[model samples]
Target: MYNKGTIIPGLVIFIVFVTFPLWYNGLNAGTVPKPDLPIGQKECVAPAAEMRDNHMKLLNEWRDAVLREDDRVMVKVGGKEYRKGLQMACMQCHNDKEKFCDSCHTYAAVQPTCWDCHLTPKEAASKKETH
Candidate 1:
């Protein structure tokens, strides 16, 4: 009877500690679809274009803010202040490369070799060896 209770507790422990994080990470790595716009709605109907334009404008503003040296919004890493770019911000909504990066890269016919040399901004390589 004690062994049976122990089995259930051990299984629960394994599920909570081991399986849960792996499942969470896997779920986080994939592309999350936008709730408002369902899949297969590629062609601009009318209002979508305006909304897209507005979104682009906001993105550009964010980019400009980061580019500005005077702007205090920055992340400090290894004693250097690095401005956050669009890629970092945008990835919050569109996490997968196929959903976000590939779409724009394909549209512009530009192949970005970023993944070859660079990890995501959050996981940037250590600068300790540079100096």
Candidate 2:
């Protein structure tokens, strides 16, 4: 081939570019974040593993049920009734958003929009005090 030298170097460059991310990241997945679980709170609306994977879907469903269908959206688990929403339920137990929510969210590189509308427990209390 007349372009042997150029073709070989071009192929090398292409392969390096294609695999750049793996090389840069060292093929290491990253450390899993362990959020601080609530003390003395054993049960949840769903199991731990289920919630880790599908909390967003559950929250969206709850929102739809409460707003669209006019349902009260109360979920009972382990004899405790929980109102379906971030503020009323999830934040009640996971009160420290930075410790409980932010840890895992940051590790997963996600920006959850839940805080956009609902004030965190600490924020709500502080706002009430200010007013």
The candidate that wins on TM-score is 2
Scored against the true structure, residue 96 in model 1 reaches a CA lDDT of 56
Tens digits of lDDT, candidate 2, 1-131: 78999999999999999999989989897778889898878989889999989999998887788779978677776677888777878877888998899998898789988878879888899999999
Best by lDDT: 2
- Over 5-61, each residue of candidate 1 has an lDDT whose tens digit, in order, gives 889998888878877867678756554444333343343222556745575565456
Q: Which stretches in model 1 have alpha-carbon errors above 4 Å?
A: 1-51, 54-56, 72-88, 108-131
Q: lDDT at 116 for candidate 1?
A: 65
Report RMSD (Å) for each prediction in the order shown.
Answer: 17.6, 2.4
